[model samples]
Target: MPDSIAPDALRRLVLPDRVHRSLYTDPAIFDLEMTRIFGRCWLFLAHESQIRAPGDFVRARLGREDVIVVRARDGRIRALVNRCTHRGAQVCQAERGNTAGFACPYHAWTFGLDGALNSVPHRQSLPPDFDLKDPRLALAAVPRVESYRGFVFGSLAPGGESLVEHLGPIAAVIDNVVDRAPDGEIEQAGGVARQEYRGNWKLHHENANDTLHPGFVHESSVSAARGDPRDYAAPAYDGHQTHTQMLSNGFGVREWQSLSLTGFPAGHSYMGGFYRGGVLSPDRDDPVWREYRARLVARHGEEKTARVLGEDRFNNLLYPNVSINAQYQQIRVVTPLAVDRTRVTAFCFRLKGAPEALFHRAVRFLTNLSSPASMILSDDIEIFERVQGGLANSEPEWLDQSRGLGADRTEAGGRTVSAGLSELPHRAQYAAWLRYMTAAA
Candidate 1:
């Protein structure tokens, strides 16, 4: 914990319907979050597909810690701190590649693919009492590393909930995507889209499931796509218009009734926005959709295939870092760079045994929507930057997140749910954040 923001002080940063600005801009708070939240949480590291063969490795970041996820010769996946034990210099410099082991360029210390100490320069120069069996000679490994359906995650904390328990209801959401594969296997395909935004990381977290902003924030883009020119200079909605009982209608006037947001424990939540087009319809005449449906039916049977393909969840916020968009076959990994900067990498996946056209469609969907040149993502990033700037002022000490505050209902398994556009997701996230942020380390 940072001495600047003690545990007791952290409690004051959050309230029932608001959060202190310092939580977004304070360096101390960010450091505490890296330790208390990211350090302990099961953070997404690497997909099994990224390290499919022995000696393959990919660099990963869990908050402030740098880790290397490697496939060892023993056919086991291992995650180790990137630092070399000899001089605390990073052993691996490449972002990712297949290598027999990592050699620290600084001191020529070598570690095996599994992070075991392999050799050191000038062995004869060592003291007589020195022993290679010393654990300190090996690279430090993360305390916990586990995978759920090929998605690997690492935790710095020794133990608590298993990976499956941390995922909670989102586990079903993940299964819904992986099961879409005809062979029940999914692989990272095509390529990755990396982007950086000058905004607080929490902004993206809140914006992921924030339904209230789409119709307004993306209004210009939507109008452009429709070949209609909507006034962009119109004043924002007045408080009266928003507070009207008829307009509220319990969920605060949402445009998509089919859209639903559900909050689960451990700060996990999902936004269900089934594919708007006829993409998932088995009866669609499109050759790609027809072929994909047939392959799924052959593997999972007609009834089961329907249920699997029909699930079109938009964004599943796994909390802290990763967001999965099953509808588009995309997984976005969020990495915080600073209190005011964040980096996001979007990966597209292909369902094994699916047709080439299906993979092409998946790639096109993510490229058009999540790529750095994407208009949708551009709008989101712009808003995030603006929000960060706006919050720097001292006038508004509290940001209101009270939408649908009293309208949520408790569901089975302790999930809190509300209708479309409700702020239940935000409330649920902050509740978990406070619990994790202030809890004993």
Candidate 2:
């Protein structure tokens, strides 16, 4: 356990447009975050589609606690601690599977899918006072579990804000993801791609909404794609480079401009310009794209369908832990393993009832962009490690996120809107980070 630091001292670490490097490297600060942020905030769990059948379960983690998200025989989903109450041993080992119940290998103690104490060996030999209904004897459960459009979340805190309230304006972005499904459903299509980095987890979420770095950091990949061997050494490539060219090669340079970045309360934000011009204009001519669009058009009018498809926010930062890209049909979950190590898992989602080719396209994007060995992502991971190492030097105590500081304007629902290249997303995140880290538990 880490000794608690005064809240005022913590506040000084986070400034309006700058933050102390210790926030990313301090073990004590990381411990406090595990309690204050991860413990209270609603963190994304397995999707509802993952546990469709009774007795189906998937292993998950809430901060430091290992949990099992299972569908009970009674058709209810529950998140239970994976530890056995009797001897403190893990009860479930499978990553995900269907089972009648979990039997602890340590003592043969059994728990039902709903986490109820179902059986114990040597019943007659046990103490007469042993009570099966005791709360401590049953498999412990997460305090709260909820889902929005099949994306499930669990909270360790007993009470705070509901999942919808926590999501706020970001809920619309999530809706864009699910609503894109022709039948209004999305499922885990392919297995997840996992990667681990020797850097803080916050860097991953911060980078998700950082649009200013792509043109510079990924210039090699872009140059390779564009067949231009010229080095990206000029200042023009810094923050003024072509936005569409910085993204995947599928998008044409003339098709779009710098994206719109929106930052809302609770550290939520999204960045993309493709929402205006549309993401799949080329795919518009494909049979798979046409078939899927027709289904959506039948359900919603042609105008509404076009608007939904065009609302292409490339990456959505779901606060502290998850980054979702609906356009790519990928959800990336960040797990902090230590003060300096973080693990990321990217899962591919398939729009239910959409054409098979559409699913294949999603997988191709996942492989080419989000995979651990991806050309684009490898550059990001390398930079994160470099940044982590650079923070260790004894020179600058604060990191600057001053780009577009005063340029952001307030929008409806208290959201802050600005050009996609702005650092408003990082500012929004640190604002929430300061609040959560300093607030009373």
Candidate 3:
């Protein structure tokens, strides 16, 4: 641990809510998070759909290193460093494409879909000791890469728990994400939106579950054509208003009491959101909607299906990488480039075998309504940026996250959860973060 750990790092963290500002503002700390947390953790790599066919590929970063995920001719997926063995040139320049093989643009060295060395301009001219069978000549696969449902993740460390084990309780949510479809799958549709934020990447992760900021922060959307959820939830029980912030907006009101905050090892947390969140459209006579609800009710019963569709979830951080709102068909990934700047990519998934319009509705909810381009998203981004700027102030010695004190709950596992709005997820994140930072490399 760094000397700056203020002897109070432990005391600085109060469970179920509140965290030290250092986890957000300190550069040294962010560096360690990138390694111990992101490096060791199963970081989101790409959707399996992104590489569905032979030679299809997408370049994703694990921490700061670039990795290329490709599908072999046999339809198996592989993730390997993008770096070329010859002079370390990136083997593939395009972000996404299908290819028979990848050739380094710098030296024209080629490799097959399996990342095997294919050809060199002058292979025989090279030294006899240049063994093509050597692992160094072929692309180096990442230590660990796996998919949960269709969501993919890459880890630099090999010894951590398997992807499913790390997912813990949220596995159900992941299943819920796809199982909503009659075919039990979800697909990337309507493309994706990428945005850069001038804040620590963790801010996005923390903010993913941030329920308190929506009503106050996203005033534009809340104030516009569809009045904000806060205003809507306040009095009239209209069923048409979009929850907009949905689950994350739960923090605005202090209804965390009686809620559960389930934190798992390796830093993941979730809690409950009331069913009366924002608004729900009356179940219409659409065939797909009818089938979906009927199937859900059949399997989980009306109460559970009602629970699933009724309230928005507080937020579920996928840990060190992705945060997903399964109910909303949204997943956001936070990629850190520096201590101060982070890029977030948000994607909306379509329920497999569902009506075409259902996916379009989700797209509208996300782009025009939820994401940064969305009026509410714009405001939320503003809030995150303001937090970044405010943290730079020399005026305050430290920042405070103390909220819902003494409310966090520890479960059967070494984890905790509190009210819907508690900052415990942030605290849990930092706790895991600290463990990673101080852990032996």
Report the number of the highest-lDDT candidate. 2
* Candidate 3: regions farther than 4 A off: 1-20, 225-261, 278-288, 294-314
Candidates in order, TM-scores: namely: 0.91, 0.92, 0.86
Residue-level lDDT tens digits of model 2 in 1-441: 653888999989998789999988999999988989888899998998889999989998899889999999888789999999998999999999999999999989999887888889999999999988888899999989999888899999998999999998777777887888888889998878889999999999888777667667788877675654345554443122232333453333233236678888799888767545543332356566789899888777899887888776767888878888776578888998899999988888888878877777677667666787687778899999999999978669999999889998987777898876678888889888988888877
All candidates in order of TM-score, best leading? 2, 1, 3
lDDT tens digits, residue span 9-33, model 3:
5445433344556656778777666
Error of 2 at 41 (Å): 0.3
As for model 1, its CA RMSD to the true structure in angstroms is 6.7
Per-structure clash totals for the candidates: 0, 1, 5
Better of 1 and 2 by lDDT: 2
Pairs that collide in candidate 3 are 211-251, 222-228, 256-419, 261-417, 261-418
Off by over 4 Å in 1: 1-4, 228-254, 276-284
Clashing pairs in 2: 275-312
Off by over 4 Å in 2: 1-3, 228-257, 275-283
Worst 10 residues of 3 by lDDT: 236-245
